[model samples]
Target: MNQGTPRLAVLATAVVIGAAGLAGCATGPVDRRALCTGFDKLGSELMSANGLFDNAVFASAGDLADLADRYQGGGLSADATALERISDADATNGFELERATSGTAKVCGHPLGLGTTSYAETGSGSTQANGGYGSYGGYGYSPPTESVTSTAPEPPTSSSPTTPAGDEVSARATLQQQVDTDRTQVETLADKWVPQLSSKNHGLVAHGTTYDYRAIWADFTATRQAYPSALLLWSGDYTSYTKGDFWVTVANQSFPTGAAANAWCVAEHLDADHCFAKLVSHTHGPRGSTLPR
Candidate 1:
């Protein structure tokens, strides 16, 4: 995670809330009201991109493309172009899209991004105080201050290690074997979960990858004091979504609906970045599904 910036989920939420690029706005010139209403519904992943072509940014391409498809001939050619640019920004190196987003807002008679609001980081890690994507704070999700590829906790290193290299190699091999085995089990579980969760309609998802099922489950729920009944899903080996590293945490906590689950998230302090409302339906694979209505 970049210490300088919030998590990508938070970034996406920020983009959705105020990135200014028209998402599913009305079929006309990009206006503030229409943009505010429409931005949060699409292209969040692209909005989250910080001008770098990496896995997280690239992961949103498919979703953004779908949104673009919906807006192809909707009298928002500039908006459509912006969406297309953001959708393909990773592949075509078009990360500099201010003209179509915030710049467009300026043309639409608004200097601010989305509306007359602002975002700030709270000490508790919540992004904002107003009713925006950054406001949801939640339990659990103690993201490591540093990025990690494997599930193993870091053990303190000795100034001079006396352990045998052969022994260390054997241990690593065993760990890798466990990882492979765990991934298969997680794969099966993820396949089973997609349709099941989708059938329910909506869920608050804490998206992540790399950790195995047991670790992911504990981290997303019980360990951090989140809903224990939450379901865990993984992105299988095959998917164009963000290099296919798996694990998505869906809190099964009950709520009629708030921001399509945003209210529940706020109650738990789960922001759109750390957690977002998802349909949890047939839109499977590593990337998960569309935002809830």
Candidate 2:
């Protein structure tokens, strides 16, 4: 029994070694190029979402806040932040991507390619005379048991590595289209509202003091909702000269472009005395900040 135990132990050791060898062969290499490809796709999709948001107009402070919260809550932000850090740390443009790919490979229990982003193929070709052609080379012909055939070393074929630039270009193009559409809608709404100011008797007119800014804001919001791609450009006072009721005129409005604002004044048929484009940077603050009513 003791002699048998020794033989079994030896056999177990051999099995373990063989198993390890098999495992090693199974986990070939990590493909960093592929990882970069996936990362690029993810980043582009996230950017597209952001662009969509930027071009959209929210109905209220709540809607604006909700959109902001959604963007932050989405995993895209975290993934993009991580990718940005990786890109920053990747001095060689190849090292960090390589290391990240390697780390992923270890976890996945497989080896991937350890090289720059490139393609390669290894192949060889050979032409040999087997018996002869037609009937001579038919299955009936029994060739020599040992036949010498020389194989030619075929040239390696490779393709250029894919780049992330194309994704960025596409994203940019999509965003620009959104911007143009949004701008046009805002202008159209401006044209509609300018005439309504007097007929609807909605805002601070020729001699009115108290301005229903919120109502006007709501009107613009509704107009923007009609055009889904319009952005939340503004919802504030359009002041020309400010003071008390005696000399001050505060006609508050919201608009996407300076041209639209100026067009509002034109549509209202107001002389240069009352309203003008209140050109300044307008942004509804972060998700939780005070939103313009």
Best by lDDT: 1
Give me the candidate number with maximum TM-score: 1
lDDT of 2 at 13: 99
- Write one digit per residue (lDDT tens) for candidate 1, span 115-185: 22222324422122222212222212333211234433332122222211223333233333433434434
lDDT of 2 by residue, 119-229 (tens): 231221111111111010011101111111212212211222221122323322332333333444344444222211110112232222111222222222222322333
lDDT of each: 0.34, 0.29
- In angstroms, the error of model 1 at 80 is 50
- lDDT for predicted candidate 2 compared with the true structure: 0.29
The Cα error of candidate 1 at residue 149, in Å, is 7.2
Candidate 1 to truth, TM: 0.25
